[model samples]
Target: MQTRALRTGGFDLLVSGLLAACLLTLCGCTSDRAIAKKEKATHVVPVKTVAVETTQVQRSTLQPATVHAFYRAEIRAKASGFVKNLQADIGDYVEAGAKLAEIDVPEMLMQRQVIDKRIERLIAEEQRGQAGVRLAEARVRSAQALLAEASSQMAGAEASLAASQAEFDRTEDLVERGSLQNRMLDESRMKRDSEAARRDAMASSIESAKAEVAVAEAQVVAAQAASDAAQAETEIERSQRQEMDALLDYATLRAPFAGVVTQRNLEPGDLVRQSNEVGRGQPLFVISQVDRVRVRIAVPEAEAALVNPGDEVTLTFPSFSAAQPIVAAVTRTSGSLDPSTRTMLVEVELDNQDGKLLPGMFGQASIHLDSKVAAQTLPSRAIRFDEEGNGYVYVVGEDETIARADITTGLDDGNSIEVLSGIEPGQRVVGPHLKRFSDGQKVAVLPN
Candidate 1:
């Protein structure tokens, strides 16, 4: 009976041990399967992508500018004097040759009066000299008449002397023959001698008359010289008077063109002087041609090559809030870069017929450059840098796994970069997963 009971207990213990071993094996297999599934799901990386498109890109440059007049002028006082009246004020429109201001020149007027008086005196002197010349001519004629009378008297006296001499000769012959008395012959001879003396006196008188005529001729010459001198003096005085009159006219200022008086420096009764300082040419009043305006800008040396004359440009002025942008064309350039600022000067012209724009206004300009070839551009954030300082991106492979790609870059326009190589259009790239990426990493793509 004791042997049979011990065998039954040993059999039951063996059965319990076998069942526990089988259960342990089954639980180990199930845990290994669960771990494999978790590892496969967690190791795969999901990435975002962008589509590449071919489009035209414009190269542009922006710069600050200033508005100016096409032609500006500064009006100054040409003649010095006291301002008498002001005809135009600031912001007044004036035509060419219009009166601007008038000056009081009392000294000039007095000078003209003096010149006139001198001319009158010279004329009076000339007339007096002419009268003297006429008087001298009359005296010469009177002297000539007296000389003719003296000549006639001398001829008569000579005839009488000849007759008396003939008689004396005959009387002397008779006395020799005792036909006449000696007293009679002496009387005849006395008569002849007296007539001869009378003829000599008349001849002397004629000579004196000729001398008087010569004196009269000299007087006429002197009078003519005086008249010529007086005429010359009158001409000189007349010329002086004309010059003073011209100076008086210069005292009145006039506008040189049709434009608005943008500035006023002096008023009535103000004293203005001419400017002679270097670089400060003049400072009386400012004038500008408001029919057209100009804008000047300085472009940097790196971008100056892209601008050209006649190109369209836009200008904006801060002074006008509701004013539309002024459209203009590039008129000219400075042609050389400035060494100090490394910029080139540019000018644009615009119409301002309404006088809305003024000189010295601040503005800005935008210049369009040449168009570039169609290229694939990516966002700047898509690019990545490695430890070796090489730029690259993560490209999605056919099996949807991540692979590191090396790329060459071109121009960067602040928002996007031109991809030169190492990537094709339509290829999926990792979107900024720079910190959590590795070579040949498994990835899951995100929907667009």
Candidate 2:
């Protein structure tokens, strides 16, 4: 009976051992299946994605700038003299062409008086010369009349001499033919000789008249020359007076344009020198037009080409911080870069009718460098850089597989990056946790 009992107990024990071993194997299989399931789930990463779409992209730059007056000028003395009647000082508004001050040019004034006297005396001389010319012309007419009378007298003398000769010839012929008395013939010859003497005396008188006419003509010429000389002298004196008048006009300083005086360096009774002289002296005044202002900016070379006239700009002045930023369009550009600083000059004009904006003020300028109207873009996080600095994105295909796509990018606005190439609209790209995915890896899209 003892042997039978031992055999049953051993079988029970073996059965218990077999059950424990089966339970252990079952637990081990369950643990292995759980781990495998977790590994499988990890391979199919759940990623957030975004669709590539078109949007507006902009890029801008900020640069320091300065404010200046629209028009400024330095007023200086044009004539050397003592300052007198100084009518303008600093902070005075003046009109264009208004007299600002008068220069006390005592010597110049005295010289002007002398010039006036000289001009008056020359006028009298010119009148005297005119009278002399009239006298000379009258003498010429008298000389001409005398010449005519002398010619008439000469003709009459010739005719009478001819008549006397004819009578003598007739008497001598009659005497030779013994038809007349000798005494009559002799008397006729004597009469002819007397007529010849009279003719000679008349000729001498005519020559004397011609000589008088010539002398009168010579005197007339001399008088006319003297008259012309007097007239020339008068004209020269008048020209000198005119030059003096112009110099006198320069003695008074006038405003070149309508503006406010921003500086004053001279006072009444101060000696002023000509501004154009060697070693130019200090300016007497500074004029500026404050109804309008200009903001000047120096854009760097790299972005100079992007700036253009008429582009919108925003300006902020440090002195007027509480004031709103001023919006204006670019007024002008230098078109070329400065060689020394590699910068381009740009300016914007604004109306300052209120006189709030002052010259030499500091400010900031925000300039739009580039803009895109319908650019393909994605979230900035969706783009990544390679070791070579090239940008890329993980694009999800229709099969839900991620394919690394290399891309070219343009303007970035912090939130979105413009895709210049390699990606099209409607394409889905991985947005975040990009490091977990690789090329050709499967992924599950999560709602974003």
Candidate 3:
């Protein structure tokens, strides 16, 4: 009976083992099916995407800048003189050629007076010479008249002698033929001789008159030459006076261009000498044009290659307003870098027509070294961080799956960030709603 009970218990144990094995197998199959169904339920999600492409970026470099006047000139005394009065004071705005100061040059005034007096004397001498020329002309006319009268007298005397000679010839022929009286012949002969002597005397008078006329004409020529010399002297004197006047005009200092007076060196009664070289002597005034100013900057040697003319630049005046920046363009640049400073000089022109910006104002300039550069970039928001804090972005894979791609970030220009590595241009990246995507998640890339 105990042996029969042991067999029955053993059979029951066998059946329990079979049931436990079958239950364990069924549970394992059910768990695997549930996991497979859950994974299969993850459908292709509709997500926005953008192509990874190159974009233009602007890069800037900051440097110190100095503000200077567009044009600066030292108003100096051109003539040795004293400052008689200051027409313009420091900070006064003056136009080009406007008088800045009046100088009192006693010697200059005296020299002008002397020139004036000399001119008057020369003019008077010219007038006297003209009168002398007229007097000489009158003498020539008188001599000509006297010579004509002498010629007339000689002609009359010759005619009378010819008549008397004819009478004498007729009377002598009558006397020889004894038909006329001898006394008549003698009277005709005497009359003919008297007429001949008068003709000779009249001829001599004509020669004398001609000589006198020639002398008078020579005197007239001399007088005319003297007159011309006097006139030329007058012209010379006038030219000299004009020169002196020009020098005298220089005594009044004038603005070389429209600008503000930055400095004043002379007061009333200050003796100022002529200043030719700058920084050598005190100037009466210093004028600088503030309507337009030059913003000068020194670019480092490393960045000099990026600077060029016509490139836009920004300037900020720390002494004036730091927030408000003045926008201008690079007007010029020194082609060669400075050996000592190892920097290249750049200049920007700024208009200050409102007279707000002053010369010598301190400022800073930002040069857009690379104004616009095309490079591989992405929107800042598109970048993501992985669990390990690595920079990455979600990309659309070839199989229409979300791929976590690692990328190296470069310059961030507020609008976009540069991708230096691990991503190629023209590749599609998940756009907005990137959080909806997970690793290996199937997705439908929407049109951008």
TM-scores across all candidates?
0.52, 0.67, 0.63
Over the stretch 289-339, how does candidate 3's per-residue lDDT look in tens digits? 999988889999988998999888878887767357778889999998999
Tell me how far the alpha carbon of residue 227 in candidate 2 is from the true structure, in angstroms, after superposition: 3.5
lDDT of 3 at 177: 100
lDDT order, best first, reads 3, 2, 1
Best by TM-score: 2
| Residue 238 of model 3, lDDT score | 88
* Best-matching candidate per lDDT: 3
Instruction: Give me the runs in candidate 2 sitting further than 4 Å from their true place.
Output: 1-53, 57-65, 172-176, 182-221, 277-279, 299-316, 319-337, 347-349, 364-372, 377-448
lDDT of 2 by residue, 20-135 (tens): 99999999999999999878756887888898888887776688989898898887776789987889888888999878888988887888788778778877876777777777
Per-prediction backbone clash count: 2, 0, 0
Candidate 2 or 1, higher lDDT: 2
Off by over 4 Å in 3: 1-53, 57-65, 168-178, 276-279, 296-316, 319-324, 328-349, 362-373, 377-423, 426-448
Candidates 1 and 2, the one with greater TM-score: 2
Model 3 residue pairs with clashes = none
